[model samples]
Target: MDLKVDPEEMDCNQPVPVEVFASRSTLHGLSHILTYERICIKRCLWILFFMGSLSFLVCVCVDRVQFYFEYPHVTKLDEVSAPVMIFPAITVCNLNSFRFRSVTRNDLYHAGELLALLNRRYEIRDPHLVEESVMETLKFKADFHNFKPRPFNMFEFYDRTGHDIKDMLLACHYRGMECGAENFDVVSHRLSETHNLILASSHAGEP
Candidate 1:
């Protein structure tokens, strides 16, 4: 038998071989290998998902156990009635003025009464501790937050004098006002509002 092959149909004047055709015909076998590879990938994904879920459940369980174990102590503390005194706000120009006679009269009276109550309640006799308690009580006054009207520079004063009592006092006064207006009461009120709204929304969402 004679076979006729066209030159135009050949690559570089050589006819295409049967082995090359056979190789091309068997290329579909690679698809089966790919299907097995996909199955392996799916199995690996399932294993990873199961492990992640298990780890998350374990963490939740540990947190629940810790929270419950601390609940009894928290409840006991909540039951104890502590003495609390509410003081009216004092409006003062500065801390130095606050230490004076005219500006802090009502504040001083309430403060002294609160101190006596605290001393009777806690039986604390130390002078330094008593002084600290008096200061802490005074801090509760509403006008405490409104006095320091501006921010004073500390870094500049420290740079100039090495240490300046007057500058530091001014900074403290400024900070107290800032705390009242910007840091303490305003933020606390906002936070409380936000928390209450969130809680209300959550309760609404629940049954």
Candidate 2:
């Protein structure tokens, strides 16, 4: 038997092969998978970035909190007393070193004794002069009585040579002391005189 082919009917109803349909379906599924993978990768990157930023912020906050806790805030006038010693025997290289070694009560007493000796040697008769000299010796600037209490770190004043006496004297002037410069000169002279007297006395005693 002979089979007859109809061109018009074949053209009107062209049947797609199963393989081609499967291939098209596979391509569409592959495209969806690729899109999903890209989205997932982008999401993962964003999450990682966010986590890193959060960790950095947390670390900064913790550091700040630790600093705040370690150093108590100064808010009272009594808390801001005069420096015990204007010139320490040992020098501090930095503020951190000064913080580690603060002034003690014994240091304050020694400073007071030195001030008393200076007063006696200088023959300072005026009460105000005596008070001013004491304050200056303790690194307390003039008008300290009226100074507003605020958070202060004495270590900030420490230079490589522990505490610079010249700087402290300058601070005294800036803080409203009228005779800071003169006082410094007078105290320096008196200290020199006292040193000479001690040496002379020691020599006499040896004889």
Candidate 3:
């Protein structure tokens, strides 16, 4: 005896149901759980595993959702009465920065051909081609990241151009009470070249 399946019967117009999708899905043992016809030990085990996995995932999602909503803190406002607070030490800095007029002619003279070339470039004139270039020019290297010592005195330049605290702070006060220049000792910032600083002395508590 021989059996044959008809092509017409195999090719149905009806869409494949969700059971087919479940069978092909990545969910481990779900196909087995759904397809199992009877109450066997294997089917019960798959059902238990699937439910436990789903529950754990739902708990994690709930925890993450709670964390997202609770990210910002609550704000509150209140009124209180207290004695006047001390005026903080103020430092004025960098009022006049990199003034071209302050650039001394001495620096331009020391800068030599580099500044000359730039000046020529500004005037739309090409650089003068030197037939006999110096050994230093031939072996020239440029590194912008590392700080190099300036040919000119940076300290003098900063002092001449940087801001003055006496000029900046015309008046000082705490809770409408006036403060004098004696309270602020004018000082240069030790760590930097450009900032003019003022420090409040320990005698700030004195009347």
Considering TM-score, which of the candidate structures 1 and 3 is the better prediction for this target? 3
Off by more than 4 A, model 2: 1-38, 72-207
Model 1 stretches with alpha carbons more than 4 Å out? 1-38, 72-207
Model-by-model lDDT, in order? 0.38, 0.39, 0.56
* Top of the candidates by lDDT: 3
How displaced is residue 141 in candidate 3, in Å? 69
Q: How far is candidate 1 from the true structure (C-alpha RMSD, Å)?
A: 25.2
TM-score of each: 0.19, 0.20, 0.32
Best by TM-score: 3
lDDT tens digits, residue span 1-207, model 3 = 898978776666556666787798898877888773676887889889999999999999999999899986788989775577354556656644434334444433333234342242222113345333422232232212353445666556556545556556777775467766576664665425356555465645642
Q: Candidate 2 residues 1-207, lDDT tens each?
A: 998889988876988655455456754343333233457866566567666777998999999999999987777555555656342122112122222134333332323234342233333234465555354444432223444544433323232214333444433322242333223221111212121101122122121
Ranking by lDDT: 3, 2, 1
lDDT of 2 at 105: 30
Q: Candidate 1, after superposition: displacement of residue 114 in Å?
A: 33
